[model samples]
Every structure is written in structure tokens, then in C-alpha cells.
Target chain A: MTLTHLNARGEAHMVDVADKQETRREARARGSVHMQAATLALLSEGGLPKGDVLATARIAGIQAAKRTHELIPLCHALALSKVTIEFTLDEAESCVHVEAFCRLNGRTGVEMEALTAVSVACLTLYDMCKAVDKGMTIDGVRLEEKRGGRSGDWSREPMPEPAAATSRDPSAEAEKPAEAEKSAAISPTSGVKIQFLAELRERFETAECVLEWARLPSRDIAGVKLALINQDPKYKALLNQRVLCARNEAMSQNEAAVAPGDEIAFFPPVTGG
Target chain B: MKIVINVQQDAFNTEVEQARLTEGRSDIGAIVSFTGWVRDFNERPDVSALTLEHFPGMTEKALHVIAREAGERWALQGATIIHRVGRLEPGDAIVLVMTASAHRRAAFEACDFIMDYLKTRAPFWKKEHTDSGSYWVSERQSDREAASRWEHS
Candidate 1:
């Protein structure tokens, strides 16, 4: 793709959209301000020394979205139909998820405006909370989705690390739980469904196995692992690595309680987003 | 109040689902809906498609629990959640959440709450396919953080 803002001589210039058709276009963007969890708590509770953190940030983002053309010199000034800013307080991640939506019936897309809104909102948050948390980081400012442009619509995909994606095969066919018949055969009577995922599935050469509770010497996770290792020496690798365990569907520890009907799953620390 | 949940591989019509929630009703003055779409790019560029994996039984169980939680916390007339599995292309609708109530606040908050819980608590995992290759999506720390905010709410 050629750069629209540069001429044949490579000098920065604005591309005229005089002949382009105006369509209803919308853009969504996201950003975040990472801070200490304690700082996030204070901001949420209105304990910040700076009064009304979110209110100030909200207004700032709206203003920024409207005046985006002024900030970016080459951007065309257009009347925006709508601009909205939203914030999600994530305590576990110690950050605030900021989202912005900008819409207009115009020749150019509103992606820059949406991105500017999110960026300003995150910066505003950091400005308000910096007194209490100096280490706050403004990050992940990017376009999420844009619709109604010549390119049609584009969205940001949810993805994992590129290195991991290229190095491994996570295709669906490879992930089908080892034959359902195999698991069924192992536990004709009372049994626990023992499933493997991701790397474990490839390494163990089985997606899942059902072990009869009565056949096992014990029923806890440790005992089940031992049984699998005894049944096939390859399963012994599970014990040496930092594999995760889930009972039913919830992550569990080795000593977590187990019963005949429980479903047990083993895998590497999840790479799912 | 009525609750409906679907985990499938089929595409859904937003207007059709919204009509179902407010069908034969005048008491519902507000209906809030959120739709999640598969995007073409993410941390890396040139993402062609996405594959979603889920634990068959647990995925349904988790959606039910999340819906029940929303029902318990809100004054609502109806709530419906639909999530799609399998391969999806850019611009495909992946999830739909709708909440209807007599007023806006309840419907809006409940819809937001359900999405927050679903992002972190759902059993589904995403694998992104790019021009370069494909890889399993990793859980986001921000997602876990977003879900945690509702624990005390």
C-alpha cells in the first residue's frame, strides 16, 4: 500500500478527498493506564487527591476526539456525528481499560479520532493518578475496529505471541480429544475424564483418557497422574514439568479434591486470550 | 424474567435476537446489547482468521452461571447470551449479549457485567491464524483485572 500523506518526492502533504464519497463511518479504539492496584482502588473510590478522576478524563477524551484534526496537521477537519468514551476498571491487571467510539458520515474514516480519544483518556488518567502512583504507564493505544471505508471494515484480531504462533501447530484437527471411543473403553463403569490440552496433547499423543475410579489405587490428582504414568511411561513427563490441572473446568492444585464423576484436565499454563 | 443462552457455530441476527427479548412486552423500556466481532489484526498484523476452542460441557455451564449471576444482580425482564465456536473470519460476529429492563441503568450495567465475566471466566480459548502462521491466544492480565472489579459490585 502506498502512503497517502506523501507525494512522489516524499514530502509530507495532505491527500485531498474532494472526490470521495461520504459514507457512515465508525471507529473503535482502546487503550489503558497501568498503575499500582492500590492506585486503581483509590481512583475508583474517589480517594485520589485530584478530584473526579474519571469525570475529568471523560471530558478530556471527548474534547480530544472532536479536535483531532487540530492535533494532527494533515488530518482533514470534518464534522463528527458522535463521540463517546468509556472506561473499565480492571483491578487484577492494575489498569483501566479505556475505549472510545467515533462516528461520522464522511469521506475519511474516524480511526484517528477514536485512537486520539483513547490515548487522551489514558493520558488524562495518568495525569490525575500520577501523584499517588508515579509509575503509572500509558500503554496499548491502538485502533480496534473501523467500518464503512473504501477498505470496507477492519478489526484487530485477538492473538497470542508471534513466536509461539510460528513455532507450534494449534490447528483444530490436531486438538480433537483423542478418540472418544478410547476414553469410553477405559472406563466402562465409574470413571473420571482426564483430558490434555495444547502442548500436552501433542506430547502425550492422547487428547483424553477415562480411568475407572475403582481401578486406581487412589483418586486424588497425584494418584491419577501416577496411574497414567504407570499405564504409559510417556505420561511420566507430566510430573517433571509445570503442567496445570483443572477439576471439572476450574484450575486446581494437585491435592484438590476429586471424585468419580469429576472431569480432570491437564495443560501448560493457558495461552488463551 | 427470562434467560436464554446459546453456544453454537452459527451466525446470529442482532435484530432477530432483540425482538425475541422484547416480544409481547410493553413494560420493557430499555434494551442494551453488545456484539463482539472477529477483527482482522491484533498484536501482530495480517491475521486472516481465528479458531475458537472450548470445553463442550463446561462452556455451557459457565455461560449459565454468568447469566444467573446477572439475573440475580439486576432487575430485568430478559437476558440472552450467544457465543459462536469454530473458525471465524474477520468481521464475523462472535458473541451477542442482550439485556432488557424497565429502565436503562439495569440493562446497561448487567450487559457490561456479563461481558466482563465472560472475557475471563468463559472456558473458550482463541487461536489466531495470520499470514505468517497461527498460535494459541494467551489470557490477558487486563481481562482478569476487568473481571475482578465486579467481585464486590
Candidate 2:
């Protein structure tokens, strides 16, 4: 028979670490916040109003590391040595990459602390910008690396340092159907999803003016306007050179034809989440 | 060995867990598991279902790390966890935490520890889906009160 403070019930308790040795332990984890290229661009450009998204998120991550146990029951409290969060701009997809590394000297590893840091950082980003970008998502928050404990310095990936991406080259790969599919599969609102419908509307409506495409370096640039009135001799030379990525699903054979005086609205697809 | 993380999933099982936590032991004294199910009854009645989203990678890592921490603090032979994701309904197993130890004290300690971990650390955002529309879960006094106890401990 089990004689203990808890039975089969939902209760709160801290993990007892009175007997565990205090050793130097550290945990490094990485998590990402995937946003629309437009959203990302806005973030990078400091268009977000919550006052420095990265700065606030970084501070939030550190605070989260220190409060891991308070937020999680059964987690033994320990002295955290260091908690650092970094952000990088991925120009390709227009997403902010948040990475957190947490260190501690205690009986157990700091994996939770590190993970907590990343999660809070992402949440902080969401909170700061949800007013403008509610569809933002946090994904792939995994242990990039860790050290100490019986497992002995284990990690699923390299000891990733903190960074983000901002505008890669506009390569032909941007136009590949497969790349668009892959981006949608990972997180449906990036890359081509953000711009497909707008492109279709512009093309079919014979809409005048420059059209911003979701081409490479997408996060670095906004939608361009095309002037349909002119032969657009310049745009003719740039055909298929660029594309738009929006926060929606990929277009299925983008085709649009609009009669005179027709108005078209392009919006991001509604996500299940 | 019992693990708990804050996230949402449809189902979790215990029978299948016994094999996982006690795989090595005929010597195990007792096994304890605490499974938390999504109750159909909330403060509101019209709640048809709920969907939970989380900082994916961070959520799992937080759970694993919490579970491992509990195991180290309390002597446990083994632990297992099952956390669900995506849309879920009432009566769904949101979390499953089980612990095995040489004696009941350790098992019980580990089990309690895991539940506590679930309440506080996991980065899951809860949305209550009702006939009206989707609403974010407001802060609950009970959860804060429960978690508050550990803050001082």
C-alpha cells in the first residue's frame, strides 16, 4: 500500500530534493515565434506598440527561468545562475526566433527553467503584439542542449546560440510550389500564404499599381504596388521574379478575372487554432 | 517518474502506462498514477468543448524537465507522462502522470510532484469553446491559490 501525502488526487507539492546532491547544471533550449511576414517585418521595424518586443521578451524569459518552480508544482526550487534570451530575425519567412539559455547550480538539471524562459519569451511576444497579430504562433521549443545530471550532457541538437533571420536573397526557390507547401505545413501563415490571394486579385482585376509579392527577403520588404495603367514595361521584365507570402493557405492555381469596377478583398485564411 | 505538463490533448491511458513505468520491476512495491481529465462541468454550462494551444517545443521540454526534477527530488523508480494537444472535449485526459518507487512514499511524492508541475509550468493557452464563441480562459482563483502554496514552500 502507498502511504504518502498524496493519493490519486490533484494536489500541489514540491519535489523533495533534500537528499539530492547540489551539482552545477545547465540547460539550453530554443523556441520560435512564427508570425506573418508582414507581422515580422513590423516587429523588426519596431512597429509593435508594446515597447520593444525583443527587449521585453528577453526580460520576460529571464523572469520565467527564475520562477519556473513557482509556476510548476513538484519542481524543486534551486538557485538559478544565469538566464539569457536572444532574438534573431529570419528574413526568409518574417518570424522572430527566440532562444533562451538557463543555468543553475543545484541537485537537478535546469531544463524546465530553460524551457520556461523560452515559453515566456514567446508568450511575451504574443502578448505585446496580439493586438496587431493574434494569429502569431510559438512552435519548436526544444532542448537545443543541456548539461549535468545522470544523463550527462545530452542534447537533441547543437548548442545553438541565440539569433533571428531577416530577408534572405530572392532566389527562384521562392516560387517553387514545394517550398510554399513546406512553409504552410510547418506553420500555415507564413511565406506564400500571406500573399497568394492578393496576387490573384491584382492579376485578375487588372488592378493598377505595384503589387508586393512574398518573394525571398520577404520579411525585409512589404507588398509592392504595380501600375496596371502603363504597359508596365518595367514589371514585364520582372514577371515571376517575385511573389507574395501572406498569413493564409497557398493558392490553388491562382486565377482571377474581375469585371470593370469590381472590388476584391484579400484576407488571411482563418486558422483552426 | 510521473510527469505532468500544461497542455491539452484528447486522451491518455494508465494501463498502457503501467508497462512503461514498471518495465524493469517485479520488485516494485507500488505504482501510483494521477490522471486529470477535462471536466464537462466548468463555471459555465454551455461549454461544448475546448481547444488548447501552447508554445509547442517549450511545453514538452518544460514537462520533461519538471518530471525529471521531481524524480531526482523524490526517490522514484520510474515515471511516465501523457499530455494531449489540439481540440478536446470534456472527459478528455489532458494529463497522465504515474510514478513507481521502492515504496509508497516515493511513488506518492512523485505523483504529487508531477501534478504540481502540470499546474504551474507548462505554457499552454486555454480557449473555452462554447455555443457563443471562442473565449480565452480567464485566470482562475483556484489555480492561483493552488500554485501559490508551492511558491512559499
State which candidate has the highest DockQ.
1
**Cα lDDT of model 2 by residue, A24-93, tens digit:** 7877778888887877755755666775777888998998888888997767676887777878677575
Residue runs of model 1 more than 4 Å from their true location after superposition: A1-187, A198-203, A212-217, A229-253, A267-273
Model 2 Cα shift for residue A159 (angstroms):
16
Evaluate model 1: give its lDDT.
0.78
Q: Write the per-residue lDDT of candidate 1 for residues B57-153, one digit (tens) a residue.
A: 7677778768767866777788899999899999999999999999999999999999988887777778899988888776677877877889877
Q: Using lDDT, give the best candidate's number.
A: 1
lDDT tens digits by residue: candidate 1, A1-273: 356788999999998899999999988888999999889766755667888888899999999999999999999887999998888777679899998989999999898999999999898998999898889989888876676766664444233223322222344223322332344346444587899876678678899898876455444688788888888899888796567777877666664445656789987643322
**RMSD to the hidden true structure, all candidates:** 22.3, 24.0
Model 2 whole-model lDDT (C-alpha atoms): 0.59
Q: Report, for every candidate in turn, its global Cα lDDT versus the true structure.
A: 0.78, 0.59
Residue B131 alpha-carbon offset, candidate 1, angstroms: 1.7
User: What is the C-alpha DockQ of each candidate?
Assistant: 0.08, 0.01
Off by over 4 Å in 2: A1-273, B1-10
Minimal lDDT window, size 10, model 1 chain B: B56-65
Residues B1-153, model 2: lDDT tens digits: 334343444455578668766766687898888876676656577777877655444456656666766665666767777677677888767767788878898889767766765665554556678777766564455665665665565
